[model samples]
Target: MATVADGHHPFAFTFGILGNLVSTMVYLAPVPTFYRIYRKKSTEGFHSVPYLVAMFSSMLWLYYATLKKNAMLLITINSFGSFAEMIYIVIFVVYAPKDARKLTVKLFGIMNVGLFTSIIVVSHFLVSRAYRVPVLGWINVAISTSVFAAPLSIVAQVIRTRSVEFMPFRLSFFLTLSAVMWFAYGLFLKDICVAIPNVLGFVLGLLQMLLYAMYRNRKQVIIEDHEKKLPAATPDHVKNLVIIATLAASEVHPVEAQPNNRNDDGDVNNNAAITEANEHEQTDDHRHVENASVEIQPNETPSAV
Candidate 1:
C-alpha cells in the first residue's frame, strides 16, 4: 500500500484516479446482466467466461502492483475488480443450469485457484527479487490483454444475430475512455507493461463501437415453418392458424432481413410486420398453447332427432 509523494508522479496520480473510476464502471457494467440472471433464477445461455477471465486479470494486476513500488492506485482498483468479478462468477454459478454450473466451477478452480497459486509460488521462490518485476509485468500484460476476450462472445453474437442489442454502445464508449486514461497513467509512470495492453484494449473498444454502429439499425427476421403437426377439426381454422403458428415460432430462428424496395410504402409495411412479430413473440408460450388448443378442438355435427 505504498504511495509516491504528492509533488512527484502527479500526472500518474490524477490519471490513475480517472482510470480507477472508469474501470470501476467497467467492472460494474455487468451488474444488471447478472441481476436479471438472479431475478430469473437462471443464467439462460449467458456465458460466465467473461467474468471469470476478468477476475483472473484483476488478480494478476493486483499481484503485479504488490511487487512494483508506488503502485497503490493499481492495487486499490484491481482489488475492487477482483472482489466484484468473483461475486459475479459466484452468482452465475449459483443460478446457472446444472451442467453449465458444474463447468463454470471447474474452470474457476482450474484458473483462479490452481493456476493463480502456482504462479505465486513459482514467482516468489524461483524468480529473483530484481527480475520479479519484469517477469510479473509480462505476465500481467498477457492477463490484462485477455480481458478484451470477454467481449468477443458479444461480438460473435452481434455478428451471428446481426443485431447490436447484446453490445451496448455506452459500455463500449466507456471502455475506450478507460483504456485511454489507464494508458496515460501507465505512460506517466513509465510502466510499459501497464500501458501496452491498454493499447489493445482501446483498439478493441473502438472496434466494438464500430460494430455497434454498423449493425444497430439492421432489420431482424424470424422465419418459422408452420407445417401443422396437430390435426384441426375445422379446415378454415387450420388455414388461419398456420400463419399464427409461424409467427409464434419466429423467436427461434431470427435472421437479418435486408430491405429490397427501399421505398416509403415498403419501409412502413416492414416496420409494421416487425412490430407485430415482436409483440406476438412477447406471449409466445401462451400463443403456442392457444394454437395447440385450436388445432385439437372438436367440431359439432348436426344429428337426426
Candidate 2:
C-alpha cells in the first residue's frame, strides 16, 4: 500500500495532522489572555515564564525535527509554535512591569538564546551523529515532561482554594484530547521520543479533569462555608415580642426588698417620718393586691404605666 509524502502510514499522517490542529489550538489558547493585556496596556501580573519556556521547547523540537528523517510534521508544527510563543512573549514584555520585563528579558536570553545555542553546539560538535538524536531526544523529553506537569501549580491552586475558577474545563478537555491524539500519532509513527512525553501529558490531563470534577461545585463550597460561619438570624418581630414580654413579666411580678427593720432601724430612722410612712403604706398596698394582677396576652399591646 502507498504511504504519505513522509513515508508514514496514512493513519499516522492523519493523526499527525490532527495533533497539529489540536496543538495549534493549544498554542493559541493564550491569545484571548494576551489580547486583554494589549487592550488594558498591562500584563496584569500574568507571568511570562510559560511563554518563554514554550518558545525554548519549540525551538529545541524544531532542531530535533531537522536532525531526524521524515519529521516534516514535527518541524512544521513546532515552527508555528515557536513563532506563536515568541509573539506571546513580546506582548508580555511590552505590557509587563519594569522589573517583570527585565526578568523576562533575562530569562529569554538565558534559556532561549544561551541554553538553546549551547545545546545545539555541544550536540553537533561534541556528540557523535549516532548519539546526537538520542541526546536531544532525551533533553526534549525531560523538558516536555516538565511542561506537562507545569499545570500542577494550577491544580494545587484549585485544590487549595476549593475552586475551579482558575482551571477552565475547556482547556483541560482539549489538552486531554490533544494528548490522546498525539500519543496515537507517535505510536503509529513508531517514534518513542514523541510517544514518551505524551504518556505523561495524558496522565496530567486526567489529573486536571479529576480535580475539576472534585471542585466544579466551588460556589456550593463557598456557600456551605459561608453558611457555617454565619450566625442564625432572629426575626425583628420576634425580637420585639420577646422584649415586650420580658418587660410585661417584670412589671407583673416586680421584686422589692424591704428594709431590715431590726438591724437597720437607725438608718431607716434617719429618713423623714413622712417618707417612712409613705413607704409602709406602699408595702401594705402591694401585699393587699398581690393576688390581683394583669395577664400579658401575646396579641395584646402593652399598656403605658
Candidate 3:
C-alpha cells in the first residue's frame, strides 16, 4: 500500500510537470512573431495589449507564488513568462512607430507600474500574510480570466472580414491545449482559482478554433455593382469635342504668326479659322450620328427595344 501511494504521488507530480511544461510552451508561442518584428523593424500591426496583459498576469502570479507555500511550479513558469513578455515588449517598442511606441509605453506604465504597484501596496498593508496567498491567487485568476477574453476581438475581426489572416490557428490550438493541461493540473491540486479561469480560456480557445475552421477557406465576396452603376462612357460627340479641343491646343499660337510678315500672318489666321470651322463641322457630324443612334424604333417599345 505504501508503494502504491508513492507511485500515485509520482503520477500526480508528473501531471503537474507536464501541465507546467505545456503552459510555458504556450506562453512562449509569440516569440517567433516578435522575432519577425525585430528583424523587419516593424510591429506589423500586432497589438501590444496581449503581451502587456500576459506580463501583468505573470507579475500577479509571481506575487501569489511568493505568498503561497510549495509554489515552485508557479514561480518557475511565471518567471519565464515575465521574461518572455518583457522581450516581446522590448521588440515591439523598438520596431513600432512613434504613436504605437507611445501607446505601448503608456500601457506598460498603467498596468505594470501603476496598477501592479497599487495592488502590491494595498494587498500588503491591508491583508494579513495568512490570507495573502488566497487573496493574490484570486486576483491572478481574475487577470487570467480577462486575458482569456482578449481573443474575442480577434474572433470578431475574423468573422467581420471573413478572413482568418489575423487569427493564427497555431496560437489558438496551443492556447486550448495549454488551458486543458493547466485545468487538469489545478484539478489534481484542488486549486479552484487556477482551474476556473482555465475553463474560460479553454472555451474561448475552442471558439476561436471553430471560427477559424469555418472561415479559413471562405473567400470574401465583394460585388462591384456600385462601380458598374456609374454612368456609361461619355457620348461619341463629347469624345469628338475633347479631341477637337486637344487639336486646337496643339495648333501654332496666333502670336507666332505675328512674327512673320503681315500678309503671312493674315493667311495663317484665316487658315486657323478654317481649321476651327472644320473641327466644329466634325463635332456637329458626331452629334448628329449620336442623335440618330438614340431614335426609337416605330414597331418596338423603348424598354423592349
Top candidate when judged by TM-score against the true structure: 2
Decoy 2 TM-score against native? 0.71
Predicted candidate 2 versus true structure: per-residue lDDT over 48-148, tens digit per residue: 77688788989999999899877778888999999999998899888889998999999999999999999999999999999999899899999988888
Choose 1 or 2, whichever is better by TM-score: 2
The lDDT, on a scale of 0 to 1, for candidate 2 is 0.75
Q: For candidate 1, lDDT tens digit of each residue in 3-97?
A: 46211478988999899999898888878777888898976656676677778888988998888887888999999999998998889889988
Give per-model TM-scores.
0.69, 0.71, 0.67
In candidate 3, clashing pairs total 0
Residues 14-44, candidate 3: write the lDDT tens digits. 5557767887877777767767777888765
How well does model 1 score by local distance difference test? 0.74
Winner by lDDT between candidate 2 and candidate 1: 2
Better of 1 and 3 by lDDT: 1
The best candidate by lDDT is 2
